[model samples]
Target chain A: MRKWSWMTILVAVMLLVSACGSNSSGSQHNKQQSNGGNSGSEAEKQDVTLSFIHWRGEDVEVLDGIIAKFEQEYPYIHVETQVFPSDQYQSTAQAKIADGSVGDVFTVFPGAQFQAIARAGLFTDLTGESFVEHFEPNLIAAGQQDGKQFALPYQLVYNIPIYNVALFEQHQVEVPLDWDSFLAALEVFKQAGLTPIAFPGADIGPGQLMNSMVMNNAPDEDIFVKLEAGEAKLTDEWWVKTLAQFKELNDKGYLQKDAVGAKQDSSIALFVQEQAAILGTGSFHLASNKASNPNLKQGLLAPITVSADEAVYEGIHTTTFMLAVNSKSKHTEEAKLFIEFLSRSDIAAEYANGTGQNVTVKDVEYTSEELQIVSEWTTKHTRFQPRFTISNGEVQKAVTNSIQAVLSGVSAEQAAAEAQAIVEQQIGQ
Target chain B: MKKHLRLLPFILPGLVLYAVLFMYPTISALYYSFTNWDGLSPSYQYVGLQNYVKVSEDIIFRKSLGNNVKFMLTVVLIQTVVSLLLALQIYKKSKLNVFLRALYFLPTILSSVSVGFIWTFIYDSNLGALNKLLQIIGLESLAQNWLGNPGIAIFSIAAVQAWAHIGQMAVLFVAGLQSIPAEIKEAAILDGASQTGLFFRITWPLLAPAAAIVVSYTTIQSFKAFDLVFTMTGGGPNYATEILSTYIYSSAFLNYAFGKAATASVYFLLLIAVITFLQFKLLRTDRVSY
Candidate 1:
């Protein structure tokens, strides 16, 4: 009987321990409240901490500076920033949002993913906010679904071919302006024992590469819109040709043998190390590439024409990243204030200068020479990438997978058809 | 009744925790499996049998299921045989045995993420140590893309999983071997039974219980393999290495198809349950006694 009583006591202690363990958050909240009590009026006035989450862990230093500025501007509001890797961000963010534990302000990818979350009422609609007026109208439209803006672009990125000028000079391969010349240059580089292109054919890389090629032969600006409207399909003649050409690069062994396995970092390393002549990337890599190989001359070029007959390269422009406020946030006002501060022209300029990324703010000038070239491209012949017009990330992912499948021995036609099937299936739904 | 009441408190806490944390989510998943819930949507409609029907028709899901089956069978066979061999080699009491046991178990302590990163470098096509070593050994022709080739990427990943987990199985086997009385083995030796003959006739038969535990564990583990696959190939090279777990994750989070993901998970659980039960039944042997 005494042993039984001891067992009961043991059980009670465990129960108490677990009960206390589960309420640790509650205890912390209470502690915060007690701390607030010490400050009195100042705490009562505006002591609120807002959680800000984004996916770019590599940009933590840049974000830290921006966050510091945000905190200084709004002393009463404390901003806690969390970063997740790009690969895991979507899944992690989705889980957090579903459980109502997401950051007060979170980053969302544009297009179908943004639309899906926004349509589900997961993002606070910033439709008529005054700060929205300062953004480029096109950028604002990118985050809108049926006239309700749920997000705003903070960074503008231009996807083009970033070439190693030294490699080009070493191999005596001219920068190609059209499809034929591109193939010719690739042959020259291959002959010179250099990888023609460092293409990370995994995840979103293949899709971006395909997008770079398709833009060369894009029938018109409305092609993506038509595809979204079900008037055009991935199996269309232009897309099939574009996909074939994309796979041709693989078939010709212009891309490294294991580009399908290598990720962005490894593939980019090839370019930075001068082992590869070209990288299909954006202005984001300019600073890092220059820093890593300071003596290597580098330049960015717009997507080459798909045909020798084409007169000009169709430059591609898209919002790189966007900031959104969680609809279920307890500190909604504070989250919005953080977003507003982050979107300010001066702040955006600072971010642009800090990260060497192009700003999406309506008339902000950047000092980065790489961004200056991107600005010129945007002014000239820029077209919205498929992500901006077609809103389904899964469909885009399917397309990326299909393109990669071609490298794994799947026929170009089959890959294109498969990608089209995904779009069709989504439409059927 | 009063005496039982005293035990109630002891059981109640554990029961409530299990109910809330494990059973509740399981029941919720079962319920969600029947609905067209995107997980983030505030409300969802119960779409009877729709997600299951989609799963049946989905080629990627079928491929993922096949990959998981392949991974399970391969890992179970390889890990079990290798670990049993190691357990036999090091079952004797010796200082060298202790050191080798610890050395073999080192990889099991490392996180799946670290293992994935390490193996990825070893298999890298260009600068990977594996290819470089192959070149150094003048076996360059035999060098292949371990993770890139869709035909063998699943096998490559399975091999890494087996390598990491073989130590645990080896330890389990050693315990089982140690449990068999020395008198039985001495009796067999007295009968002039050779070592291999003794192992086959006695030791193998007695290791059934341990084999059951190991096979069941490995099967469930192989079915639930996600972290290594996620960290390494990301179900890529056209999803050649995608297993059911990674597929379910992608479906739920990436595609925002929670209902489909949940349905697949339920199916996965049922499949694993049936397989594990069959495994225990098949591996069940008459208890060996002196």
Candidate 2:
């Protein structure tokens, strides 16, 4: 009986130790709350591991260069990179943010989703940082909401109409500047037995291109601001006129025959294959187009000349990608340092020239003539529309889907009506 | 009492784990479902029945629930019938039968994520193998966007689900088929019955237990269909292929509406429970004496 009691005590002690071990570790972790930039007293040169997440398959080498420089400068911190596929990026990032397990820094598109994240205080405020000062005002404006800065422009992209110069030269046609001339150019290409404009009407990106055209041609940016504030409806005369314009493009034979079945990449490939004479894409396509057809002559960036007056064309700045630090990060200072390093003019130049990205930094030197032209155009005349900055993901998706429906035979009026209803539902009006 | 006390030490760990990991979280989730929480804010309000009210009016939620029910019914009925038929044909002990059974079960081993992607490529409108084959066979007019057309996308996704799980069901049915004594089959053969009659009368009657298991499993899985719909249609072309799991995911992650997502999950749990209960009740069989 005494031996039995001794055995029981031994088992009890073992169990208690195990339970206490697990509970203590969990409590210790839970005790370390995410209070931004509050550095606890630890070894000054303590070994720290930081995780950075982004989606950049084409510019991975440039990213590696930036990471190397950061590590060389901050020897105490080791950075690990996790690249998620583009399709799953938004949901995956959201999941990480919800679970309080987001990486120190992550990539975010400049729009309503980013705004919501910033509004919820999910990203560190980078307003006073030197890197924020270095960015162009429009680029900085894209990442700002409620007068607070939450992200920095690490890479910049501008949506422009890129035509196959070789095809244009072959057909003896000049690129069109205004909507009327653009339609006429399409007629010329169609007569020559070539697809005039490859529109990925089936996908959301093509619909976005249509939206961009409408936004660019708006009387002023105030219309978009009004729309965001619920003071204006898409069913108004301006939107009706815009829908008419899109319908006009569709009626003309300039658009691809099966635009509803085309994808953005496939549409771009059509231009590369010389099947289509024109493709509208961001400046990121330079590397891909060159790779697809090495001997293809470079195309011109036909500014979306919506109005005869150059004033309307001069002030349209589309949204670009931005880098945001997770507000819940324990290492906010280190994350800020990384963002600052990447935003430096010299570093931006290295990234831009090496990866063929048209960056937004004023001091970055462009190696390619195409990038140089886009940068110059952006600097000379561009304004970030507030529509792109509203924090409403559902509304954006609804508008995108409406575009797809319209391109697939749903009347533009019907699509606009449905899109207006969805926006109203989202804002609970 | 002392002997039982010794067992307490052995059982204590598992009991604690279950209470902490399973019971606590489930109960908490149920409680949270009645609140209005945006997941990140430090505070939330207890708005009883408001989330449920919103769910009732939500068009996507209703559509997804309907799709889940449709999937459950089709997968449960068709998969059981097809798998049982295949099992009956290959019940004999032949090398070819074994090889074919193994070949049929290959899809069950691949991950559902990979299978979803493979089927997406197969259903691609422009560059898919299916469309290309249709064109080759002069059936070009029949080629449609299988995953994009809202009318047929759900059924197309259901067909893939059936293909992926039919093999496992077949193996289960085979085991049930073999468990029946050979003398029963022999008696049916001598009763002047045709092969088809023999199966419908004797073999299928004996396979009720296996059918119950397969129906229950497949119904649960179909209700939880997420990856395939997520990868293929993304519940798109106007929410045609949406399911409860994806709806819950979008609500929780995209909208950050945690309380609503938790409410959606409770609905899912209730759905699975009711379906399982009905299946067991409807398919209940009395033991047969030889």
lDDT winner among the candidates?
Answer: 1
| DockQ of every candidate structure | 0.35, 0.27
Please give each candidate's TM-score.
Answer: 0.90, 0.86
Taking every candidate in turn, the Cα RMSD to the unseen true structure, in Å, is 5.7, 5.7
Error at A51, model 2, angstroms:
3.6
Candidate 1 lDDT over A1-429, as tens digits, reads 787788657755665455434334544553453333323223444688878888877678987898898888788888788888876776768557533355878888776568677767777789898889888887656677777888888778777678888778877777677878889899898988888888877554675666567776774767776876789888888778877887788899898987777777778889999989888766568878877887767777654756656744466677857888776666667777788887888888877877778878877877976667667766666666765556655566666787777877778889888778766765554
lDDT of candidate 1 at residue A27, scale 0 to 100: 41
Q: How high is the TM-score of chain A in model 2?
A: 0.86
Per-residue lDDT of candidate 2, residues A1-429 (tens digit): 786688657655555455435434643443455552346124346766677887776778788988898899989877888888765666566556533455788877776557556655677788888878777776666777678887776666655556777887787777565766767778888988988877665454443464356655565666655665799887777676666666666677667754654557667777888888877555567677877888766554443536555425443456465788776677667777788888788998888888878776768888875676567666455555434644565566565666556555567788778778767766667
Best by TM-score: 1
What is the docking quality class of candidate 2?
acceptable
Compute the interface RMSD for each candidate structure.
7.1, 6.7
Q: Which ten residues in a row have the lowest lDDT in candidate 1 chain B?
A: B281-290
* Candidate 1: residue A243 Cα off by (Å): 2.3
